[model samples]
Target: MTEPTQDSFPVTPTNKIRVAKRANYDRDTLFAILDEGLIAQVGFVLDDKPIVLPMAYGRIDDQIYIHGAKAARMLKKLKEGLPVCLNVTLVDGLVLGRAAFHHTMNFRSANIHGTARLVEDEKEKYDALVAITDHLAPGRWDETRETTKKEINATTVIAVTIEQAASKIRGGMPIDDEEDYDLDFWAGVVPISTSFGPAIDDARLKAGIPVADSIRKLTSRR
Candidate 1:
């Protein structure tokens, strides 16, 4: 995710929230969070009406690529050039608390707000689809066959430039109020983790793909 990038999308022009500033932005840092997960919550407004929808995404260069069935209401609405905010967040841990008021979760999140555009170029769309596949499973892009003409025709892809985005991170133990901190109780982080499970081959997996080594070596659980 850290390949050097121009990050042509400037952080200053796009941020609306001051709490979530872009000073901490480093392409490698932000996009790694985007790359580690496939789901994103996209926010948009149509005709003065607001919308936020969660969908799958892939990152290529400085753009966030997302797709949904053409019939998806969010997709249909977003295709109208509405301004959108895309949120990608990963919960890293649950903070155990001495008081309910102190309960919190350690997380990494990025919120991007900007106008989204429907990708009309066939070549760019093809590349974006491959990036989506690669984002889900690294080697699958090369291993899986390309999208069929009909499949491409039916899918809708949207791209959001990596403009002003704020990355907010919360980690470590809960900090209870001064009075509550003295309460005798467990107050530490309950670590949460994400991992890829063993690849499950289809019963009909054809002859010799034999699960590539890249796909086989996964999972923290035995």
Candidate 2:
């Protein structure tokens, strides 16, 4: 693929997509996929072996933030500036074809390449935490109790600047062989979606404490 313009991340060997037709280099496309995703698969090398872990992440501009316990192995290794690759995917549907070989899925996914660095600035760390919390449920940070110094101290946050990224998207019906088109078999897409269920209050909550507005708003949207 050719190098993309300024509006998109430049195409590089590390971030190139083999299926050029499905590749998208636009910043909007990449960020859209990232923003809608609830989990990210982070890949890195540890002890000369490859490791991939699912993590909760938040995006701020061109960077992604991931946090965990201070002593977590992945956080410790990534904070040392090791190369990392993060991926988020949302399955939109299941594509069923007449032939078994043509069965596939409709999905949107973003893959990012960068190096993670420990967040040292106090304000930045706090903001990153808020972004993460809101990513899970909008406006959740403001609706909850403030984080204590000890809680903040025990958590470790790392920022990964998006150096290179690409998004791949597939939608619509399945493609089958010309001969299979006339076969007596079903072929179509089964749409898939994610929705939020009614909120359940904590068992230990005090009497008369209703659901927070953030939680109500989030569930209502779905």
Candidate 3:
């Protein structure tokens, strides 16, 4: 597939970054970051207080989905079609510099601004749940039991279109002053890695049931 250029999205004031060179508006970049992110911090206001809630999220095309109990305050407030800000960040490394002032971190972050609407249709909600599950576990959706009517009715899902989004990325070694470089200090980057641990069977698991191949593959890919 052809990659969309960074100029595809408009450079609005809310989505613009002070360091323009570090900002990316490419559709591909935004989608990549969103798909890789397991959690998102959703920002919104309720009762005159601004709050940020970390939630599990899924991305399909240009849409992001987050689900929770129907009675959840955050989900109820968000379904009212209020403006929201969603943020996802992936820390790549710890950038250490010779000087304290020059210390920094290497990371990639994406911020999205838009309004979320409730997803009520049965098929769409089911698909959204599948997407969410697959985001957490690549192929576990099909292995689990199907969603029942009672369960479906108890849950609420919100869909947010990628109307305005931007990604900021930083990498490479630390930047230090020339004079500081000559001082007796160390400077380098400590890379960060992510991995899934081995699966532990449930205490009540049925006898002789082996770990699913999908789970093994998922953990192995890390």
Candidate 4:
């Protein structure tokens, strides 16, 4: 397979910087971090004012898809073809050091900059919504309320080309100065983790309708 194209997001020299060597520019690592993240904060400029909104997103082939109710004012500007940026980040751990100034958090983060385009085609809109649902909780859309023609028309979906992006990662314990390490103090990493639990059945569901295998699998193994 051909290597996916990538562009370095122009980070202003004045922007905050930590461990520069841990910054990753490869497309594969960036995409993997994006895929694991559950929420993306989309940023856009409208009328000289900047706005940021957190929303769910899904990756499709070579594009990133996101949407909101068509009537929502937040998405109105986006649907108007405004340029937008999407960012997803996951904090992996808390790196503590003997020196207070050296405390830091390990993380994996991705930021994508691109012009947003509306999904005007009906079939494409359907597929985009499906991708959004499936990306969050796989196989759940099939069991939930399907989007109606009116609902579909009332929602706005935007697809942005996957370009001008990169992922930055920082992990492991604190990298303290030699003098700081010698100071007597406790220092180590506090790991961060995510887990799913038992499925809660709806009180209204018929007793005979057993939990679907899809959900059963999610809750079966911690």
Top candidate by lDDT: 2
Write candidate 2's Cα lDDT for 1-222 as tens digits. 466687898888888888988898999999999988999999999889999999999999998999999989778888658889999999999999999999999999999999888899999999999999999988899988889999999999999999899999999889899888999997899999899969988899999998999889888997
Better of 2 and 4 by TM-score: 2
Scored by CA lDDT, what does every candidate get?
0.75, 0.91, 0.86, 0.79
Best by TM-score: 2
Q: Give the alpha carbon lDDT tens digit for every residue of 152-201 in model 1.
A: 88899999876566666787878788888777888899888777777788
Compose the digit string of candidate 4's lDDT tens values, residues 117-206.
888888998999988987776776787776799988888999987656667788898988898877789999999987676777798988
Score candidate 1 by lDDT: 0.75
Of 1 and 3, the candidate ahead on TM-score is 3
**Model 4 score (lDDT):** 0.79
Between 1 and 3, whose lDDT is larger? 3
Residue pairs clashing in model 2 are none
Runs in model 4 deviating more than 4 A are: 1-19, 220-222
Instruction: Give the Å shift of residue 79 in candidate 4.
Output: 2.7
Q: After superposing candidate 2, which stretches have Cα over 4 Å from the reference?
A: 1-4
Q: Residue 44 CA error for candidate 1 (Å)?
A: 1.3
